[model samples]
Each structure stands twice: as C-alpha cells, then as structure tokens.
Target chain A: MTWSEYGRLFLRHGWLMVAGAAVCGALALGLTTVQEPVFRARARISMIPGVMDWRMRDLTKELARNAVATFPSDELLAAVQDQIGLQTDAEGLRAGWDDGELIITIEAFAGDAATAGILARTAAREFHSRRSLQFTEQDFIEFIEFEIRNREPELQQIAPNVMTNVLAGLFVGFAAGLALVLMLHWRDEEWLLTRQAIEKSVPQPVLGRLRSN
Target chain B: MNTNPSSRQQDAQEQVAHELRALRASIELACHKPARSVVLLSPDNSVPTADAVWNLGLAFRTDTSSTLLADSDMEDPGLHLLADLDLAPGLRQWLEQKGQPASALAATHDHGLLVLAAGCSNEDPLQWLNTESIGWFAPALMACAERVIWRTPPLDQSPVGVLLAGSADAVLMAVRPGHTRRSRVNRAQRILAQAGIMATGTVLVES
Candidate 1:
C-alpha cells in the first residue's frame, strides 16, 4: 500500500490500533511493577601477573592465608570461599570464574542491602589474600599495583544488568504488539482490497489513452 | 400577439424540445436493458426529466413487459407536473390506510403511463414514507404496473433516503449539469447506500 492508502486505512480503524497499543503497554508496565525486586551485589577481582612482598603484605591476607591454602588447589572460587569463612559460616559464599576478562566475580543475592554489600566486600578481601600467597613477596606487591590498575578500568566497565534486562522486555513487548496488529489487519476483510487489486479488478472507462510500443 | 411573438416563443420551445430529445436518446443508450424494476432517484423537484424519460423508453423497448413510472416523491411529486396528470392520492394514502384499495389510489396518464403522486400534502407526510409502508406499497404498485419506474425524492432531502422499497434490478442517479456538485452527488450516493439502493449506473442531466 502507498502511504496515502495506509493513512486512509488508519483513519478508518485507528481506534483498533490504539486499543492494541494500549493493551500492550499496560501489560508491560503491570508485569514489571508486580514482579519481585531482585538486587544483585557484584564485586570483580582480576588476576595480576606477580606476587606480594613479605613485609608489605597486609594483615587481612596474613591472617587468612592458613584457611586459604587448606584447599591444596589454585582454584580462585574455592580459595575465596575458604578465606571468607564461607566454608564454616551459616550462609555459603557464591563466587565464579569470569571467562572473558580472566576475573573472578563474587556475588550474593539477599533480602537486605547491607548484608549483600558486606558479603561482596568480604569475598573480595578473601580472594585478594588467597591470590597473594600464590606468588613471591616482590611479585605480590607488583601484582597488587597491577590489580589496582586493572581493576580501576574494569570496575568502570562493569555495569548492572538492569538496563539490558529492561530493554529485552521492551523488545518482547514491541514484537508481540507488532504481531497482534498484523494479525488483526489480516482478519479485517476491508483491508484486503489493495490498491493494486482495485485498479486491476474493477472495469475502468477509458476515455483516451496513449500507447507506447 | 402577432405571429412573430408566437414564433419567438415557438423557437424557444423548439430549442427546449430539441435538447430534451437529445437527452432522451442518451438515456436510452445508457439503459438499453433493465431488470424488472428500474428505479430512478433524484434529490429534489428538478427531475432528470428528459434523461429519465429517455432511459425509460429504452428500458420499455428492451424489457419483456411494459415499464411503469411510479413517482413516490412525497415532498413534491414532480412526475405530476412532468407527465401532466391530476394531483390525486398516491403512495401516502395507500400507506396511511395500510390496506386501502390499490385501484382507487392510481391514475393512468394520457400516455398510458401510470402515475402515483405523494397525494395531497399532509401535516407530517414523511411518517407514511417509512420502510414498513414502503415495503407494502412497492409490490402493490408493481402489481398494478408491469415494470416500475420510481420518481423518488432526492436522497439528500428525503428521510427515507432512497426511492425504491425493495430490490431494484437496475437503479440510476441523475445529476443536473452545473447545478449538482461532486459533493452533493456523493452525499446523494451515500444516502442511497444507507437505504441499500445500489445504482447500476448514473445519468448526467444536461441543463
């Protein structure tokens, strides 16, 4: 259909389209509002390529080293869990490997905001202490500097997934709306008489014509 | 009055007569063959006189039986003046009585044409022009005449919206040149559409 025909059709049944859009927008807002709010606490720890010095190492790492090395393996998640007291605590720590940046992210989902913040900080501390023991004293100080530099830029890059999730929901809603509009238009028999069909089907009285060979 | 005065009047009449004849021939060509009922709808008292007459003649010639011109325009029955007939009881009286004798309501014109007027004016003439009464009158009028030619009121002004009550085998709308604008013609068409009267063709009445 030409733009004019589309405009005419809409002029004829714009109310139906408006109703469909209203229903879709209302449903999207209602669904989002009624959903339970989930807050995610994320902390990032990157792998720096050196070891910490003996004298310069912090007390937080020195105290946690015994519990950190008991695992006998270099897995960042298990080491961080043991150092953070998650292995003996009431609620366990949740930490996972970041394949993209060679980083380990420790996240905890909780009903309250304060508990989630503390848990994220505690896990980061534990992971840092465990990472310190894995290298020499000189290497550890260099790694700390490297970690700080890497983390400054990396933390800036890590954003909450709320925006992505919201946009995904919007896309789904829009697609459903488009499909619904098309379905309704399909059912409307009046729209079936396209301009092409009108010109071809109806007998037109030809007064004069110029034929081009 | 001398012969010259009469001759000038005669010349004007002759011009009118020539124009009417040309209009008649055009309509005849347009409506060469018609179904059982050929209904003609107009919006006002200005009947598509020559054109309708011309078409009716064509319809009469081509159709199996005789054609009847039944004027159902209650407001101003133009056929009474055009066909030169007495103003008598027509569709309105038949509807008012509901079951009045059809024979008494009709009059034969000098041309062997049956003319049914809107009858003498009433306080609320339109009340009888409703669908129910029109439904009763249509067949009764058709039974009295063979092929019916309805001189209906202009759809724009008439409350009934259309002239014919039942399914018209063929219908035509007549518009006077220069007088009938496109909008009025469209409005009249819409009126006919609402009344479920679909015209087979249209007649352009040259002034």
Candidate 2:
C-alpha cells in the first residue's frame, strides 16, 4: 500500500491501538498498587581452616571454595526449611560468594521481615550441621567447633518499581496493538475510497470521478 | 410561457440552456458521424437524464432536425411527466401490446420534439430492452429521426441500462459532484466495460 492508503488505515485504527495501550498501562499500575512490598535478608557464612600453614594455603582455599559452592545443596537446605516459615526449596533460594572464596552470603526475599530473617539464619545453620557430619570421631579433634556464625543480618524491603513496570507495559502494549492493527488492515482488501484509490486498486484508468456528498 | 419563473428557476433554465448548447457541440465533435440513439444516464442517478434528452432533442428540433427521445425506464418513467406528454401508447405499449411506432411517439408540445415514454407496464425491463421489438426500433428510429436520445435506469440498479446502451450508437454519463461516490463511478465503468460499451463522454453536473 502507498503512504496515502497506509495513512487512511492508520487513521481508522490508531485509536484502537491507543486504547489497548491505556488498558495495559492501567493493568500495570493496578498490579503495582496491589502488590505488597517484599523484604530481603542476607546471612554471611565464613569457613575457617583447622590449621594455618604456608604449605597448606592452596588446600585451605580449595576447601573453603567447595564448601561455599555446596552449602546451598537441597539435602542440607531441606533440614531446616520447615522451620523457616517460608516455602522455599534449594532451587528457589539464592546464595553467592563474592566477598571471598571462604565466605558465602545466603539471601532470602519474603513478603515479611520475619520470614526473610528466619530463612537466611536457618540456611546458615543447616550448612554447619551437615559439614560436621562429614568428620569421623578421630578427625573431630582436627575440625573442632565446626559451627557457623551469623553476621548482622541485612534486611530491606524491595517491591513495586512503578515507573519501570508502567513504562514497560506501555511499550509492550503499544507494539502489540500496532502489530494487530497493521495485520488487520493488510487483510482487508476492499478499502478503496477515492478516485486515485479506484485507479490503484483496479487495472482500468479512472476516466472520470464524482465526489461524494 | 412560464412568465412567473422565480430567480432560482430562471437561473436553472439559463444553466440548462447553456449546458445543452455545450453538450450539443460536444455530441457533434465527439464523433464524425453523430450517434443516432444515445443513452443518457448518471452514475449516482442524480442527473435528470430525461431532461437532458428532452433539452437536447429540443436543441436539434430547433435546427430543423426531428429527434426522438425514448424513456426505457419501466420502474419510474419520468420523460412523460417531465415534458407533460401522454403516457399511454408508449414504448411499453409498442413492445408488449404491439402498438404502432407512430402511436408510441408522444408529442412533447415543445418545439415539435417527439417522446417515447415507458408507459404503464409491469413487463420485465431487461426482457423488454432485449426483445426483437427494440431490435427493430433502433434502426427504424435512426431512419425516422435526425437524432435519437434514450434514458434507462441507473446502470448499477438495472441490467437494462447496459443493455439499453447496446441499442444506442453512443453513451453519455452525467455525473453530479458531491452526490456520486468514486466507487459508484468505477462500478458503472465496470458494468459498461462488461457490456462491451465504452462511455462516449462524461457531463459533470454541479448542484
């Protein structure tokens, strides 16, 4: 279609697209307004080596890194998840070791502050209990006090970034509506409405034209 | 004498007279041999084809040439009413009742122009135009008059319009601005093309 035809089609359907955009924007705003704020709490876990020796530095670092990597396993996490109040599996929970290979930070985001704090603290405790079970009676002396310490639990509420979500919804809805309008216009072939339109649609030249009242 | 013609009526008369003169010149110049029978119609059915035919016939009659105006529109025959002529013993009577051609000719009581109105009849219009009677009427009218003008129903409304065009030597389309849609014009053109008749010319009629 030429620009004139496109202009005509858009003139008819642009309002529909704008309406769709407004509906989606309202939906985004409603969702943001109704959603409760969530709180995120973090618990840091630091692994300590039994013996500090220059020759054993690499082995100590390796052990600490492995412990950090395996601390959030499902079997270890399930041990205390029942006490945490929130229904979170190992896959749904998040943990990271950016501070150092020796330290892992377990984090939980929950609708309430109590649930977030409980999840973070319980996850750290479960890791210690499972690590202790790995040592035998005779080796218990070498790995004495295999217990986890909780640092100051960081807690903050995070929810409803209104501006970002509304903007995203507006853009997505506008794009979808525009695509729909173009598709519908393309499908409608019987849209000739002018003297030039008659000439463009059919093979015959328009010898004469009469205007509509 | 229409002595009390209003200003609007006078203006309409002057416009029609001027347009008729221009149309007469167009008719003569459009073809080397002037058409014996010309079909006059409008795309939007706004132009009074009967009036155009009657005035054109009057134009020829003043020049000492007798003209025959036939209204083949059985649905709403206006040629008789427009010219104040007798409706009976008309084209329908000639086609169905086998009335004589001379009996069908209505004296318009204006400048000796003859008219053949679509008289009171319920006969199928398409069949009436296609019959062997009109087959004889075409050449017979050509021999009987100097020029012949005919009016049929709007082409889009009736198949008789294109069929009537086939009986005539030329076709004149009256298109009124602001009344006829472009699509209507295109459809009329398509119908004419389908009937193997090209419009001889177009007359732009402004309200």
Candidate 3:
C-alpha cells in the first residue's frame, strides 16, 4: 500500500493500532529497564613516525616503511600496565588497530561511575608511559589530533547504516499495519455497496485502489 | 391561500397525498396477480416526524378486509409512538414466552391495520431475529394477512428488512429525494433478485 493509504487505515483503526503499539512498546521498554547496565571505556594511543638515519640511501622511503610497520608492542604494553597499576596483566587489555591509530577499549561492570572512570584513565596513562615516548602535553595533544584525522574516512563510511535501519523499520511497520486492516475487513464480508458486491462476484482479482486525494 | 412559504408547504403536502394515493392504486393493481402474500414497505420511518408512518398507512387504503398494514421493522417502530400504544404484550414478549409461530394478532386503532411492533425492551433485535422462531412463525403470519404492508428497517444496513420482506411478491424500492443513491438502489435490486424477487416499482419519497 502507498504511505498515504496506510496512514488512512491507521486513522480509521487509530484506537486499536495505538493500543497494540503502546502495549508492545511498553513491554519492550520494561524488559530493557529490568536488565543490568554495562559500561564501556575506551583509551586511544597515537603512533608517531620515527627519525631515520641519513646513512641509509633510501632514508625517506625507509621512514615511510617504518611508520606503516609500527604497532603497539607487548613490551611497551607491560610497562604501561605497571605504571597504570591495573590488577590484571597487559595481555588482559582489549586493543585494536584502526588505520594508523591504536585504540585500547576496556569494558567493565562497575557498581558506580567513579570507579569506571578511574580505571579508564589509569589504563590510558599506563599505556602512554610504557611506550617509552618522551611526550610533553603539547606533543601528546598533537599526536592525538593526527590520529583523529587519519581515522576520519573509516568513521564516515559506517554513518549511513544507522539511517538505513531507521527507514527500513518504519516501512515494515506501515506495511504490517495496512495488511492487518485489509485482513480484518475481508474477514467480516461487509459488502456495503454494489461496487463491493460486484467486485466480490468477479473471478479476477479486485485491486483496492484508493480514491485520489 | 396567501402567496408565501406556508402556501408552498400546503401545495407540497397535497402533492405528497396525490402520490400516496397513486402508490396505493399501484399496490392494489399488483395484488391482482394472486400471489400468496405481498409486503409493501413505506418510506415513512425515514421521515423526521413520528406520524409519518401512520399518515402513509392511512393514505394507502385498500377496501379489502384481509389487507394488512404491518409494523414489522424492529429497529425503529414509529407506529407505537404515533398510536400511543403500550410497549408490553407485543411481538418480542410473545417471542420470548411462546417461542415463535407467535401469530396472535393485535389489531390497532386503524380497523384493517394490525401492528407487530419491536416490543418493549432495550436490546438489539438481531438476537431474536437470528433465531429459529421467526422462521417457524412467518408462514402463519403470511396466512393471516392477504396483502401485508410491512414498515421495515433501513434496507442497506439491517437484516430485519431483508429477512421479513426481501422475498415478497413486490419489494417496493423506497428512495428519499437526495439520500438514496443509484449505487444503493442497484444493491437493493441485487439483494431482492438473489432471492428470485423484484420490486413492483420504485417509490420516489419526498418528506
């Protein structure tokens, strides 16, 4: 059915549809409300290009190669864990590489928000210290800015998925509601007018076309 | 008569009376065919006033002794209101007590017209109508009246009119000036035709 036709059916059976939707939505929300809450914390680490020796003839290409190969090493992670004072070892930390940036994500269920935040910040600082990078506050800020710029293209690609799901849900719900209204009327066999009676008697399929607005 | 709206109203009433007399003649002519029973439907209940049905009944006078003006429409029996009759000991009570073949006739103020009203109760009449009792009682009622004129419910929506008068020798299609549509007339025709019946003719009613 067209969107406007579906809307008219909804209005005709407005009370019934609203009652059903409200009951269903309330049950869904109630189910969600009763479940336990889980908190997720993320810490970011930016990779920097290393200085190259001029004694190598292909120094510029070598610098590019080294930057591409660079990753968060286990030795650096161990040093960070010790500094951060985390109860678990470095291997327990969750980490992933996106573009040239490394993101360490920590998910924990805490009784309170304060404890979760403390654990997140401590982990981030520990990782930074263990990387053996001599970083001034200004240098750290610059590195974070560079990594964000590098990750922009990948983030942009996933945004359309959210919009597609929203439109898809609305279309499906409208079709379901229209089908329900037609089914109810057909079951009752209310041939109110001659047109309706004629249509029923015919062997061909009678398409229910809406009048022009 | 003064030349004003009241004078125009008087002229209209005369015209309606003329038409009613003509319709009465048509019904009488129809009875010449020797059918078992003929049910004439009056477009009076659809009128604004309560006396409309009674007035219509008086207008269509046939001198035959067995000719009956029946009040069979259960939805809105305007006859009871016009005749100032009690709502008790009538059709519904008889149905409940005796359970169909309830052919005990009640003659009203009009000597020839006998009424079967909706009865005294606040309930949807379909419950009683959909029972086996009316079927059992209909043949007996048919026997009592030579030519029965039944004032039935709205033909488009209610089954009361369809069940009582749909299969009569002449189901007069009653159409109000603007309210009745061609499509609705076609529907009424089909309903009657399905039962191997057709109207004597269409009556154009103006109220």
Candidate 2 off by > 4 Å = A3-192, A201-213, B1-90, B98-123, B131-134, B140-159, B167-195, B199-207
Best by TM-score: 2
TM-score of chain B of 1: 0.69
The superposed Cα distance between candidate 3 and the true structure at residue A191, in angstroms, equals 20
> Could you give candidate 3's per-residue lDDT for residues B147-181 as a string of tens digits?
55566666565556566664566555554433444
- Model 3, A131-184: lDDT tens digits are 334333325323321232121111112222434444454455455555676765
Estimate the TM-score for candidate 1.
0.39
Better of 1 and 3 by TM-score: 3
lDDT of 2 at A155: 84
Comparison by TM-score, 2 against 3, better one: 2
TM-score of each: 0.39, 0.50, 0.40
Candidate 3 whole-model C-alpha lDDT, 0 to 1: 0.48
lDDT of 1 at B103: 44
Q: Lowest summed lDDT over 10 consecutive residues: which window, candidate 3 chain A?
A: A204-213
Q: What is the TM-score of chain A in candidate 2?
A: 0.63
Worst 10 residues of 3 chain B by lDDT: B41-50
- Clash count, one per candidate: 11, 0, 1
What are the Cα lDDT values of the candidates?
0.51, 0.68, 0.48
